[model samples]
Target chain A: MKRLNKTLYSVSLLAMALALSACSHDDDDNEISEVAPPQPVTYTYQIKVTNLTSGQPASPIAVALHNADMPLWTIGESASDGLALLAESGDNSEFLANTALLATASAEQPTLPGESMEVSVSIEDNAASTLTVAAMLGNTNDAFTGFTAMDLSQLEVGETSTRVSVAYDAGTEENTESAMSVPGPAGGGEGPSEGREAHDFVSMHPGIVSAEGGLSSSVLTSDHRFDNPVLRISVMRME
Target chain B: MLRFNSKGFRKTVLATALFASAGLAHSADLEVTVQNLTQGIYFTPILISAHSNDASLFELGETASVELQAMAEGGDISGLATATEALSANNIANPAEGLLGPAMSTTASVTTDEGNDVLSIVAMMLPTNDGFIGLDNWAIPEAPGTYTIYLNAYDAGTEANDEIRGSGAPGEAGLPVPPPLEDVVGNNGVGVTATVANDSVHIHPGNIGDDDATGGVSDVDNTVQRWLNPVAKVTVVVSE
Candidate 1:
């Protein structure tokens, strides 16, 4: 994780320079300059994510390359509508489209328990020093897990960074774990609900209370309860 | 030209070395601010210690020593303070004087003794039997800068988390409900369990709060008392 964070830091410094040029205002606006600015060195990163749960299968992962100015998620705040859509319905299209994401990629299929999937994403024509990876646990209501705006610039060529990500509540939906809201096979593939019953602020997941354990109203079983560090993610700079 | 340049470089190097040595000879005064980030949990009296590198308050996966048990179970720092005093450490006890509520914060400052180069802080979280927020032996960097650290909740491994209101003395079986926490916590809990599965210092498994505040599986308020791993934020500023 530390190595990846360092690589991201270096990448972000270069990205910052590019972002400044992209948004810089010149004193002379009389002539639109046709000269193209120097494009930042593009780097390709391959991220491999593994679902470490015993039974919970993860939805498709959302891998993005962006600058440090963008933070995909933060605790104690309300979830973005884009994030809400992804967490509740296991879709990444809206998340990628809504955020000014430099580049985005996703797994082709749902990653099952103890399963791993690798997706490669590249930033073109711009310097991007940070990377954010997000994915949802399809069994829960709105629990998504991933890193946010992590520095990727310090990574040298051919080096990799790894992190164990804990689950985070999106605060967009409650953990009803009912048959009508969950998209996992345990809930028979229910998609996003028209309305939510979860908390409104993003926070650390309090974990599931399955019916087998205590919460009598929960439709979840013992298989639904999970611990921390649910996902092991590795980001390797390929270029 | 080469001789003159070498002579000037040597003089500059000597001056730099002298300045660095003089800086190291001085002590540091630090301003510490601690915030309880959890919305539902309350922190008892806080104990911030600046001790030597030789001592540590707690270690993960280890059994709680008698002194650690007293602090974790009852929020008492007298034992740990005595231990640090034996080593001539700088200590700050009970900056908040009493329970610090959720989203509240407390600040304190301390001037470190020359050799007390490490800093650590601890506080017991109420509504739990033996859980405490701790910043174990962190190396205080000599550089003059501000540093922030997040603290995790730890289990003392001394008693079972029966989730009922009980005594705060070491080796006691249930959680202690102080006057400030009595109204906040619920009652008529059937008791979560009577088992201490992992008898070593470990990350707290989190509270098992129920929707029912008056009578349920747990005496803790489900909406108000449960927390994630990180419970406290510590910011330290090292002054020259």
Candidate 2:
């Protein structure tokens, strides 16, 4: 049986950027611009994500490539409705629909435990860019794992930057672990709930209290529990 | 606080850039902030220190040092402080004065002497047997920039998590129920267990709490006392 121990309850986003800032030099493209404002060069990146959890399958990943100045999520801030939708129900439709997005791509299927998924996204005519990938932990109330707006300009062509991502609680909903409250496969797979949340500010996820432990009312079992560093992402610039 | 740096500051930036490339940091001036991120869990007095690379506050998969054990079991930082002082380390103890309640934060500033290049932190969690949040010996960067680190809850593995009323002394059974915890923690738990299975420092499994108030399997509230990983968030701003 899994020990399903107590982990920290601090929300954190660890984004490690091994950057090489070689921006697009427009010397050659200047000749083409004389005819038409320079045909936009496509900056494409292949994002590979590996689910590292024991049981939780990562929901369809929502990959957003943008150049925003701020991070997609913060430790002490409240979750946006887009994040709430992805974290609570394993849905990325709302998150992808977020404004200020430069380009977006998503995985068509769930990435199960110990599995990897590759999705590519490209943006045209952009000089600066960052990457954000989000997916639900498909077995909890609001656990999601992904990277936040990581600067993509640091990666030279054919270079890959990697980081091991940890799970985060949306903090929009309480982690009650009730069968009705959980929208994961362990519960009913009902998806994100449309309701008021408990904690307004985001933090690290305190772990699940399953019936296997002592929360007799908890809908999660021992397998539903997890630890940190749940997802590993490798981002490489292709074009 | 975002400090906008530019070309006019190229000298320091270049020096820092070189040091960063070599993955080394010399003496640094730092403004540090730590936040307790839980909704219901409280952190006792905190300890933050900047020391040499050879020293560390806690080591994973190792036996608990007496100093770490005392802090984990009873929220004591005196021993650790004295030990750190012996190393001529730059350390701050209890910036919050007392218990840092849920979601509360504290800040401290320190200037590191040459060769003191690592940062470490510790704070016991209330209503737990031997759980404490820890940041063990992270290398302080040479560059002047803002860095954020998340702390994980660690079990000192010195005592059994009986989940009942008990003493706070090291090697003693039970938790130290301060006035604040007394109001929230229930009484007369039959004791969860008498022996600890893992007697070495490890990640805490968490409190096995029940909803019972007067009589129950455990004294801690299942909803309130349990926590997940990353009990604390530490932000450090390095300056020239």
Which structure among the candidates has the greatest lDDT?
2
Top model number, TM-score: 2
Worst 10 residues of 1 chain A by lDDT: A22-31
Give chain B TM-scores in order: 0.88, 0.91
lDDT of 2 at B49: 92
Question: How would the docking of model 2 be graded?
Answer: acceptable
Off by over 4 Å in 1: A1-40, A189-199, B1-40, B59-70, B74-88, B91-111, B143-151, B167-173, B177-184, B194-212, B221-240
Candidate 2: deviation at residue A101, Å?
2.3
Please identify model 2 stretches exceeding 4 Å from their true place. Answer: A1-37, B1-26, B37-40, B52-66, B101-105, B179-184, B198-200, B211-214
lDDT score of model 1? 0.79
TM-score of 1: 0.75
Across residues A1-239, which tens digit of lDDT does each residue of candidate 1 receive?
A: 34456777888799788767766745254367688688677789999999998777888988888879979886667778788888887887888785577788888888888999999998765544578888888888787888999898666658899998887777677565677777777776566766545546676776776666555556678787787779999999887
lDDT (0-100) at residue B116 of candidate 2? 75
